[model samples]
Target chain A: QQPVQSPQAVILREGEDAVINCSSSKALYSVHWYRQKHGEAPVFLMILLKGGEQKGHEKISASFNEKKQQSSLYLTASQLSYSGTYFCGTEGRGGADGLTFGKGTHLIIQP
Target chain B: NAGVTQTPKFRILKIGQSMTLQCTQDMNHNYMYWYRQDPGMGLKLIYYSVGAGITDKGEVPNGYNVSRSTTEDFPLRLELAAPSQTSVYFCASSGGLAGRNEQYFGPGTRLTVT
Candidate 1:
């Protein structure tokens, strides 16, 4: 099943912070985060495995809570380049080769 | 290395027509996947392949088919095209390992069905 994302859209100014959350009903083995600019392919941001792990990429980071089957992406001191749609893909314990993705969270940053 | 590449960057198909979207990867990854993204929506998996000659259906697989004859190629086929099938198609490849499953995506094929 596809995961659910919170705050369908958000707007922030430069130097602001934002959080996007993703939750799945099934037990997940790993969570992957991606960012897509307008008219471009989605770019991998980071992946958080089970065991309540957290991963970071520059000013962006994410946390996965296996117990709750939830993951959150954090963008600190947002930059104009951070403006894009963010998606979280989850791999369940069911041994599926593909990850189920959330609808996506649109983040817009202004100068 | 051209991590992932897709052919036919843009196409327009008539109803009931058929077309194939080609995808290739130079990463030698064992896992490849096809996904469709509607405007303003997230990626939806259509099909996936574990390796050569191994394939499986994913969410929203109807109206589409796929083949993985070689480790480097996975092509998606759309038979009897419908307007609903018009979307941006993306091909991705992954290492297929526990912690190394980060997918590398192709530019994408934009298709429109009339």
Candidate 2:
């Protein structure tokens, strides 16, 4: 099943901070975060594995709570370049068939 | 390395028409996936392949088909196109480690069915 994302949209000023959350009903083995600019392909942001292993996108950070089957992306001191749609894809413990992505959270940053 | 590439960046199809969206990856990844994103919506998986000659359906697989004849190519086929099938399609590839590897995505193909 597809994961659920909170705060469908958010607007922030430069230097502001924002948090996007993703949760799943089933146990998740890993969570992947991606950012997509308008009319562009989705770019990999980070991946948080079940045992707290995280990788990719040094500028962006995220946390995964294995017990809760949830993950959160943190954007601190947001930059104008951060404006885009964010998606979180989840892999269930059953297997890594493919990621089930969330509807997406739109983040807009103004100068 | 031209991580992932897609052909026919934009296309328009008439109802009941057929077309194929081509996807290729130079990364030589073992896993490839196809996803469709409707306007103002997130991506829905259409099909995926673990390797050459292996494929499977995903969340929204109707009206679509796929083939993975080689490790580098995976193409999505739309048969009897309908208006509802119009969407931006993306092809992604990941390394051998399923959940541990980050997926690289292609630029995407925009299709409109009239």
Candidate 3:
């Protein structure tokens, strides 16, 4: 099943902080975060494996809670360049080689 | 490396027509995938290949077919174009190794069927 992302959309000011959460009903083997700008392909951010520690990219980091089957992307000191749609993808035992992604969280960082 | 590249960045097909979406990666990755994204919707996998000779269906594999005869190429074939097939198609590749599942995506192919 596809994961669910909270706060379908969010607006943030430069230097602000924002959190995008993704939750799944099934147990997760791994969680991946990606960012997509308008008309562009999604770019990989980080991947958190089950029982793995948190991973970060620049000012953005992510956490995976195995017990809750959830993951959250943290964008700190958000920059205007961060304006884009962020997606969280999940893969579990039954998913095999495919990844099911959440609808996505639209983040707008305005000047 | 070119990462991943897809041919025919845009196409419009008439109902019942057939076409192929070509995808190629220069990174020599072991895993390749095809995904379609409707407007404002998350991507849904169409098909994937774990290696040159292995292919598998994904969530939305209907109305589509794929072949992976070589490591550098994975092409998606649309047998009979339908309106429902209109969407942006993306091709991605990954190393499929430990801590290397991060997929590198192509720009994407936008297809419209009417």
Candidate 4:
């Protein structure tokens, strides 16, 4: 089940804020967030396991809603270095099934 | 220690050619995975292994094959490549622990089949 992400792309200025949302049709056991800079490998940001759980990485944070099968990533006071593509991967009702990711949200932070 | 490493940063192949994408991780993770990313698209799982000698197909495993002979190494093979197989391939590994879902990723291999 490919997760659905909102705001496929967004642009923000330095010290700005943004949110990227991901939802899935099926139930999600866990949600993983990662960021990929241009020409670089994707770096893990954080993971939300239980419903209503939240995790953070520096100025970024994420929340998972088990009932809605949705996850949201919040970027606070964005910086130019924050410019990258953000991906939300969901491990849905898993046994042996691997993580399925959304299309991704391209974030651009301008100075 | 190198988290995860993939060889052949980039490659161009002719149709019907065969090649292997090498992946090795030093973290001694229990789970390893292979994925491909298309232009402006999310990464799609190609194959995954929970342990050595145990591999399973992913969502898109049509033209690719994988083998895990050791804990630290997972290799993906392309047999008779097709133009549709051209994509950026990534290798990843993770511990089975709940909090360790954050998989370590390697710089992907960009493969183009003509």
**Best by lDDT, which number?**
2
How large a fraction of the reference contact set does each model reproduce? 0.49, 0.61, 0.48, 0.46
Classified by CAPRI criteria, candidate 3 counts as: medium
Residue-wise lDDT of candidate 4 within A29-93, one digit each (tens)?
78889999987888989888874565547666777888998889988988898899999887733
Interface root mean square deviation per prediction:
2.1, 1.5, 2.5, 2.4
Better of 2 and 3 by TM-score: 2
Model 1 off-target regions past 4 Å?
A: A53-58, B97-100
Q: Looking at model 2, give its docking quality level.
A: medium
Looking at candidate 3 chain B, the ten consecutive residues that score lowest on lDDT are: B94-103
Candidate 4 Cα misplacement greater than 4 A, ranges: A52-58, A92-96, B97-100
- Please list all clashing residue pairs in model 3, or write none if there are none: none
Q: Model 4 over residues B1-114: C-alpha lDDT tens digits? A: 988999999999999999999999999888888989998999999999899999988899998899899999999999999999999999988887323367789999999999
- Ranked candidates, highest lDDT first: 2, 3, 1, 4
The per-candidate TM-score of the B chain, in the order shown, comes to: 0.96, 0.97, 0.96, 0.96
Weakest ten-residue segment in model 2 chain B by summed lDDT: B94-103
From the highest TM-score down, the ranking of the candidates is 2, 3, 4, 1
TM-score of chain A of each: 0.90, 0.95, 0.91, 0.89
Q: Which stretches in model 2 have alpha-carbon errors above 4 Å?
A: A92-94
Q: How far off is residue A18 in model 4, in Å?
A: 0.3
